[model samples]
Target chain A: MIQVENLTKHFGPVRAVDGIDFHVGEGEVVGFLGPNGAGKSTTIRMLTCFLPPTAGSARVAGYDIYRDSLQVRSQVGYLPETVPLYPEMRVREFLRFRAALKGVSPRKARNARVEEVMDLCGVREVARKLVGHISRGYRQRVGLAEALVAEPPILILDEPTSGLDPNQRRKVKDLVRRLGEKRTVLFSSHILAEVEQVCSRVIIIHQGRIVGEGTREELVHRLAGGRRLLVQADGPAAELQAFVGGLPGCSEPRITGSQGDFTRVEASLEGEEDPRVRIYTWARERGKLLKELALAEPTLEEIFARLTLSPAFQEGEAGEEESP
Target chain B: MKRVLVVALRELLAFFLSPMAYVIGFLFVFFRGWETLALAKSFADSGQDLNAFPMLYAMGLCGQMMAVLAPPLLTMRLFAEEKRTGSLELLMTAPVKDWEVVLGKWAASLVFFMVLWAPTVLLLLLLQAPWLLGAHLAAGPIFTVHLWVLLAGGLFLAVGLFCSSLTQNQLIASISALVIINLLLWGPFIVARAGWVPAEGIWRELFSQVYILDHIQSSFGLGLIDTAHVWFYLSTTALFLFLTVRSVESRRWV
Candidate 1:
């Protein structure tokens, strides 16, 4: 579990992480989405107690990050962005060292935990290879095993799949997804699709502040404004626009695409309701056949763009997309 | 304490695996053996006071130069390499205190320092064997030499670790350690020998206090255990290690 309140960090003249607030519950996988230099790494560093917040505070696993850093560190596993590993150490040796460093008690237990996490991250095959000699994908897996060696209840991984191949990326996503079922995972990534596929809730950050935070559907629906409707009808484009304009709770009808037999128009309802029934009755009365009519929500990519680029968002709409 | 031991053991493991440790060791032994044999040959030919071990203590001056060279080699990679490679983040974020990391690293380097000098223990045995074989010799000089060697070795390692902690560049760390160790070891000797200041009064005492050559010869050269000299070496070790811890902690904040 994690709770942050107005968390801020400034590096001299640069505000690496501006005032921000968010929470992550147990067993929830939260994706921290941001472009490079967007303070995502800075935020994770503060949570992991690697960097002291210049202002505000945070708590991880119920322990204050500033005051109880050791306890927080012990409770959460961290994988840094570059995965700093001792190049000369073998994969298994490094994990064992990490296990011991994380306070996995007793030699036997530490070794067993190292073995388990190696298997979990699928690094068993390269256990004896020097970390420097291993491929990038295998090295990333080794980093994951190191993070999981202590069996911490929470994992804070900064770009876990940054340099991996597509196959490796998919494998890491699957691992994160499976791990999230039993542990809290907060992983940062610039890849929107990775965040979408692996995270239940996403936190979008830009310019050192949180621009948006919510589930995918919530963000999409909030930005999409009203229920988006796509109507394809067997009629002229101008007639379809007229029909949409004449119907109640319908306006802004514009034909987006057209075929020989049907024309497609994108329209939306005016209020918290659908206009399918009104459109259907109006179509029957007008002697017009409706080919298709469906409500659609905005995509995560579009919502992300709108949230990060909009002038309203720039003025600070922090936590504006949280679910009601 | 347990965490410190874990880190320290890991540090030792890394040092043993590194080539720098062995290279420095070989050089120390090679040069040290040459110096020791020359001392023995001088005593044998001149038929001077054998018990005084003037040449042995003189060889200690050579050992001290080696001390300056050896520690920087062993210590260059301690903190500097960690920072360069970024593993320092892992070490700092682990459930270990800043003091523990500094102390652990210093302790490991000190251990390697001792290992580099461990071969000298055999040399001491061979040199002292004459007494064991019934030749007339005093054990006092042997004990004194060992004492000065231990104290001076510790001071060198501490200085070396402190230099290592100041930068992420290993070459810079090594070079800085060399300069600092030389200044500390021979700075007073240079000033005293240059004859720029009064030979008597408080300045002489001040010079003797820092003149490692004087400290080694005054306390152990005469077989006297001066608590002040002991305190000097011990306090210097503590001071540098404390500074190293502060340097490491400031790194986390910045």
Candidate 2:
């Protein structure tokens, strides 16, 4: 469990993490979504007590990050972005060292925990190889095992799937998903799909501030203003666009594509309205063959783009006043 | 204390696995052996007594130079390489304290420093062999010289670790440590030899206090256990270790 309040970090003239607030409850997997240099890593570092917050405070596992950094660190398992490791150490030896460093227990218990996490992270096969000699995927899995060696209840992984191939990414994502079933996981990523598939709740941060926070469907529904209709008919592009634009509750109808005698048209509709009947009647009266008619579903990527890149979100609350 | 040992053990393991440690160790043994043979040849040719066995072996120019050179090489990678490879993040975030990390690394390097000198123990034995006249070496002075070697190496290794903590560049760490160690070791000797300070004044007293060569030969190198010299080595070593811990903690703020 983690509670943060107005956590801020400034590197001289640059505000790496501006005033931001968020909470991660126990046994919940929260995805921290942001682009590069978006204060995601900075916030995670602060939570792990690796960096002291410049202005605000945070607490982990009921311990204050400033006064109880050691306790806070002990309570959380951290996988840093680059997955730092001693190249000379063997994989199993490195995990044992990490386990001891985390104060696992007597030698026997430490080795057992190390072995368990090594298996949990799927690093058992490469346990004897030198860390430098292993592939990147195993190195990442080793990093994960190192984090889990102590069996900390909270997991703070910064870009756990970064720099991995698609297969490795999928594997790591599944691992995180399974691990999150029992522990609180706060993982940062620029990949929306990864977060969508793995996290139950997502927080979008941009320019050092939180832009949006909710479940995937909640974010999509809240930010994607209206429903869209896609209609394909055998007609002139301009005429089809005009006809769709003239429909009740329809606006911004545009010709999206055309081929041979078929043309595709799209339009945004107001709430709770299905204009398929009206469009079918119009097409029948105009002697036009209607090929397709359906409402388009908005993806998380589109909702993220609207929240992060739109001028309304750019000026933050200031641009909200200008938006209808 | 347990955390400190854990960190120290890991560092010791890393040191043993590194090629640089072997290269430095081989050079130290090779050059020290060469110097000891030359000293033995000169004593034999002049028909002089070899009562100065410990001083020749332990306080020789080659031994002194290695003290200055090997520490920086051993400690340069202690913190600098961790920073360069981003391992310092995981290390700092671990449950261990900053002082634990600093002390652990310094202790490991000091242990390696002592290990590098282990072959000299055998060389000391070989000097007392029957073919070499079975010279009766004074054990008291020999013990003092070995103690001085440990204390002096501890201080220099602390300085090197401090320098390593200041930068991520291993070359810069080694070069800076070398400069500082040279200033501490040779600076007073050069000044006093040049006759720049008054013969009997506060400046001379100050120079005498810091003159490590004088301390080694006149006190620790002999059978005398000067608490002042011991305190000098210990207090300065502590000062550097403290500074290294502060430097490590400062990384979080930066």
Candidate 3:
């Protein structure tokens, strides 16, 4: 329900968000993956009408971000990166206030919606406490509750689980998954695992531009090119590498780690085939012990690093820092 | 309008819940009461009539001093604190209009300003009650004088709100507002008294028009509702508030 076309934002001469184009379909859970200072927050801010883009335009929920900002804002609920909240207000009271500020009406429905989101976000226990007195986990959940209070059709959450403990992170991830089932969700994060688990589609942004975009499997298969085999054997390292490299559909093996006489090596496999059985059978025939032989899936982390850490991206980051 | 009231109600609730507002209210009542009683004692000792009482009390040095000092303190945190804490992002992204946020804050501060003045005005009125064995008081001058206070206080608070919008530092906001209020309240009087402008010309007439002391002492202090002075307070308050709204809008740009 969001359309962005050639959107750019500049803080003076620093281009926080360069010209970028992307669209999020209705009910699609899109993960905006980018490292810090990659313009993720700036893009979300422009979409939410929090910051006007320096050039280009966007339409959120069928409303122009510039000409119909109020309509777009009413349709979208945004949780900023830092989760800004009034410290003096109680959680319930704060949500109620946000409800009103978002034009939640009938008073009774507003209160009911606030209560519902409080329960949905698991913030009912801390509802009576002052926001400042609550822990960070509670604060983050309260920020989520505030966004859901108005029952908007679209959600733009910027790093929703950035500072939470593992348990809290899982809880928020699950909540986001559940929320995305009914509403369009565009969440940004640098955490590869979280995005891998939560988002249906991933868009990787680097240096204010979209560097990679696809499903997790598509990205892995496209960038990784082949499957990986993790092999551990108690044998001479050079001979073991030569043997594994000579196998069918297996490329040259690289020694990855070691423990005593056991050497851990990883080999890239070319075609769709189970090489585990072949490796084990061949090692037994050759009078060599195979400690471990398993096919391992390439992780999103590796793919993300390969895509985002290009030499050009690093040089651009260095140049940006040195310019001003 | 409804959204404006919603924003205003939140700000009003914050002020009431803070200990600082109570402290300010107590200090204002205590000091203004003491000053009133002290002035009354002086008048009685000199055998001067009570007819000049409301005029002196309303346009007196202490009233003007409080006017200059209290509003900046009340309005300093209105925008600056929000900016510092990053809550302005949440506030601005809401479905409400920019002017609504500005007006809501200004409205809340104006309400609290009235709250601060209520007890003092009640005390002054109480002194005129029959049970206190006090003189018969004319209602017109008393009402007009307090109206002047409200208008002048509104202008001062608007200036403070504008200053608060320009920075994220609360101290800077309060200090700058104090400077501007002091200048607005006393600048014309000082310039005219020092004969900086020509004595008899359009420049001198313009000085008189802008002179707050003349507006207070000759107009509001004597219960005359000079439309020019009323327009002056209103238009200046609007000007500052409009500037504040612009300042708030400028946040999206930079």
Candidate 4:
């Protein structure tokens, strides 16, 4: 539902969103993961038509962003990073206002749509309360409801669960996941775990460019060299490191740290192997106690770090180089 | 047109809920009342006839009151509050056109100012009490004169809305509106004293009596319906509203 090509937005001397390109298919929930000042919000703003791009082009639902901004805006629902709202307005009143602003016709239908979205976001009980009187979590929910009041096909939410508690965050995440079942969802967030939990695919961005984009498993397999392990031993740190280093398929072991009587070791295996059992048996025979041994699968956070830190991850090809 | 009405309705509702509208309305009534009562006392003390001139003078005072006071309070939050609260993004990104938003906001403030003038209609009615109750008292042309004042008040509100759209700081918006309104109201007096424009026929006509206050005082104060004067107020309103639309649209690009 969204196609961005060579999209670059420059703010005077600083390129806030440098020539990045990506697309989210219909009914796909794609998480935009980036650190602060990584151009996530800028990209979303350009897509939402709040800020015009300095160069390049984008298309939303087949409407050119530059040529058909009104159509693009009408087709998408945007929840800004700050969750702007009128504090004096009640939840229902605010949603009604948003519905009217979004061009919803027939007053009764507008109110019904507002009610539906409010109920969908689980904010129907407090619909009568002024937004200013509500808690942050509820206010975020209200913001979401306002965005959905128009019933736009695509949703662009920036930091949707930024300030919510764990339960509220889970509720919003689940709601987004459910919504993504039938609509396109593009959300930007700095929280890696939140993205991993709800996003079917992830796009990692840094310094105004997308560094990597793929499914969680695909990214882990691509970035990580298969089997890796972390071993903790109740023995001398040097002895544990030397023994693990000498094992087959195990690279040089690095002493992670010492906790109580146990020493932590991180080592990369050469190939897919059940090296944990062999390490355990060797430690038991040598009279060196093994406290814990677990295979370390690559995580989104690690992939993100590797992509951003690698010298090969150039800015120009960061976003457009991959798809899936 | 629907978007305009929706925005207008929301703004009007906000005006009734807020205290600023009430304060402006109360000040308008109090000042006009004081001026009328003072004129009545002066006529009584001098043993002169109470005529349309006294009511005209009071109407002029009303025009000055709105010119100085109404604009700042009414237009201070036109675009400033939205920018401050970050709702400008939502409005700008919506499908509604820029001109629609500008016109809607301008019309809303103008409507609020007009509602504030509603109480003045009662004041006009009260001013006609003597003529209605007593046979010896003469009716004055205050009603017609006050209509001109209302027109001038609408112009001020429109100009104020434009000024408010220029800035995101409420204090700055209010102060800018006050300065622009003052310049338009007193500009002729300053130019006449300084002799900046030629005191000849066409030049004098073009520059001297073209000030808002001069036209308003002449047309409304004398109960005269001049098409030029009406067009002047309307054109000024349209120009400001157009500028407001451009300013709002430029924000999307910036």
TM-score of each model, paired residue for residue: 0.91, 0.93, 0.92, 0.90
By DockQ, highest first, what's the ranking? Answer: 3, 2, 1, 4
Higher-DockQ candidate of 1 and 3: 3
Q: Is the docking of candidate 3 incorrect, acceptable, medium or high quality?
A: medium
Model 2 agreement with the true structure over A1-324: per-residue lDDT tens digits: 799888999989899888888889999999999889989999999999988999999999999998899999899999999999999999999999989999999999999888888889898999999999999998888999889999999999999998899999999999999999999999999998999999999988888888878888666556534478999999678888988888877889988888789999999876566789998998899899989999875666776787678756656632342243
Candidate 4 per-residue C-alpha lDDT over A1-324 given as tens digits, one digit per residue, 9 for 90 to 100: 899988998888998998888889998999999888999999998898888899888999999887899999999998999988877888888889889988998998988898899889999989999988999899899988887888889999999999899999999999999888888999899999999999999988888877888899767655546457789989788888888888777886899889988999988876555588888788889787777899877778777777777757544335346443
Q: Which stretches of candidate 4 lie over 4 Å from their true place?
A: A231-250, A255-265, A269-293, A308-324, B41-51, B54-63, B131-143, B199-202
- Error (Å) of candidate 3 at residue B249 is 0.4
Candidate 1 per-residue C-alpha lDDT over B1-254 given as tens digits, one digit per residue, 9 for 90 to 100: 88788888889989888887888788778888878877776776777777567425545656766667788888888999998888888788788898988888888888878888789778767766663323455667667767777787788888888888889998999899889888887787787778865868998666677777777667777677788788888988899888888888885564
In terms of TM-score, the best-performing candidate is 2
**Which 10 consecutive residues of model 2 chain A have the lowest summed lDDT?**
A315-324
True contacts kept of each: 0.57, 0.80, 0.77, 0.64
True contacts kept of 3: 0.77
CA displacement after TM-score superposition, residue B151 of candidate 4 (Å): 3.0
Off by over 4 Å in 3: A232-240, A246-249, A257-264, A270-291, A312-324, B130-134, B197-201
* Pairs that clash in candidate 2: none
Local accuracy by lDDT, each model: 0.83, 0.88, 0.87, 0.80
The regions of model 1 sitting more than 4 angstroms off are A224-227, A245-251, A268-294, A319-324, B52-62, B128-139, B196-206, B252-254
TM-score for chain B of all predictions:
0.90, 0.94, 0.95, 0.88
lDDT of candidate 2 over B187-244, digit per residue (tens): 9889888989788988877777788988877877667788888888999999999999
How big is the positional error of residue B217 in model 1, measured in Å on the Cα after superposition?
A: 2.0
The residue pairs that clash in candidate 3, if any, are none
lDDT of 2: 0.88
Q: Give each prediction's root-mean-square deviation over alpha carbons.
A: 3.0, 2.8, 3.7, 3.4
